[model samples]
Target: MLKLLYNKKASAALANLSVGGRLPHAILFEGPQGCGKKLAADIAAQYALCEGEQKPCGVCSQCVKVERHTHPDLRYFTVPAGKKEFPIDLVRQLRQEAYIAPNEGCCKVYVIDQAHAMNASAQNALLKIIEEPPAHARFILLCENRSMMLPTILSRVTAIELELPTVEQCAQALASLRPQNSPEERQAAASGAGGNIGRALSLLETGKPARAMADAKKLCELLIFADRYQPLEILAGYDKDREGLLAMLPLLKGMFAQIAVSHYAKTGRDERVCNRVTPAQALDAAQAVEAAVRQAGQNVNIPLLCALMVERAKQALH
Candidate 1:
């Protein structure tokens, strides 16, 4: 069964394409990371090759193969590990492959993961294939941003934009994925991840959410009153795992969000448990951390992100 969260606009639009008996030769599934662009691309590929009366009837051979990544007609390209960009030569090879007939289906589906990773040269190389795709060829370009794409490339493909899922939605999805986790634990993990299911799952599976929360809380307290380099010293623990570092930022945001929430309570809340900082300060700190995370996605160096984040948090909280 294929289920997605918080992407109704794209669902309705893509559904219309299949129901109306027309499918585009090239599609750009543009969205932030972990927003299910790749998942939607997989579903579209299966829908195109499904032979059943209802397209993407999951039990069909085509749908099953796509699910298992065993489909002969589906081709996927991604930047190899340690490579920052999708090489231009790969695009040239893909252009050659687009003309070939499908091994078992009506069309050849090429799914490009992280099209933003395709530098200018690589994107220019891909421009021709997308501009004049073969009759039996379909392309899905999974991207975090479309602004990086060439205007010529943008003009040729159907664009399916996806937005982030809500915290409640992320929590619900986490419950299904990890029934072993208690509802409270799942909710905590979900909130800590700021509605990114992939990050929440990473935190849960590695048993790092609780640890990250404790550490982030400590860092916040230290920022309120500690040595100048203390916050950076704490951040150095996450140098080896980028995802752990990523999760730490949101969990820290969650901490400040809690502070913001508690700051407004009338009389009964414990200010000690939530921090003594004003709501405005807490909110400012949260926004700073968010900005740092955004920069990290744009290829900011990890050391710089850590230094910037620590300094920002210290300034806002202190």
Candidate 2:
């Protein structure tokens, strides 16, 4: 029921439970950013709250209200902008609200985003309610790292971990989400994001991320084949664009990762994960990029660093 492009396992598991009318009262959706955990939580909440026979039939008023976030029965808790952690004060308030009767829907859905931001006391306050939640209440916790939660709290919920999609899968997802983008554009965004479709979407939706990714991809191709000066010329545009320069580093590292994966694939080891680049020198290139990222953080001279990075990459690739 989640409209996300990937993470089929989590989707299927949740769907099965909803259809069987056996969905858990408390759930945890955990993964790195852009892995679609939040969206999964939304869909699960809708499915659980829907009153229709088919359950979460999007046409039903209950489902529509949940989608629009106008449902009185569905509430959320997240850390405020300036707060360093999810405070116990708010958790206590949530606990008190949890027992109240739903105003409209068959059940009440409670969504907690960035659940990892809850400190020890805050999670403890939350554990009390989830340990013995009201029969009409469902809790969904969205977390960046599952380990951040207290063991006791984690045990009380059904946890689902989301995985990153492959580049081709990401490209297809992006194609569906952004029909205006060319396949090549979607593929570039997918590659630049390290196969995170959410990140790819952000790259396409925001011109800055897309521009930085374009520069990184161009520099990657030039590093592999261009003359030394040509590559240096490419780096010059990033002279004052610190954000762009930083964004390019991960992508440059990813290109080396692709080469390493491609090498294993050629040996028939990891055929499921494919990459276009083949290199006898992937390790060297990867190390050079790592060093550049490290040095960039230490206030090095910009122009000197840029030229040196190009030279190091050129030598490593050659």
Pick by lDDT: which candidate is best?
A: 1
Off by over 4 Å in 2: 209-227, 238-318
TM-score quality measure for candidate 2: 0.72
The best candidate by TM-score is 2
Could you estimate the TM-score for every candidate? 0.69, 0.72
Name model 1 segments beyond 4 Å from true: 210-318
lDDT of 1 at 110: 98
| Clashing pairs for predicted structure model 1, backbone only | none
How would you encode candidate 1's per-residue C-alpha lDDT over 1-318 as one tens digit per residue? 565567888888788878845578888999888888878998889778888777778888888998898999999998988999888888888999999999998899999999999988899889888888899999999999999898988998889898878878988998888999766556657765768887788779767766666777787677766865988888888776565565567667766776788767787666664565788888988888888767655667777888988788778877
Q: Candidate 2, residues 131-237: lDDT per residue as tens digits?
A: 99999999999999999999999899999888888767887888778888766556657755667877878877666555666776777777776788876787787
Question: In the order shown, what is each candidate's alpha-carbon RMSD?
Answer: 6.6, 7.6
Judged by whole-model lDDT over C-alpha atoms, candidate 2 comes out at 0.78
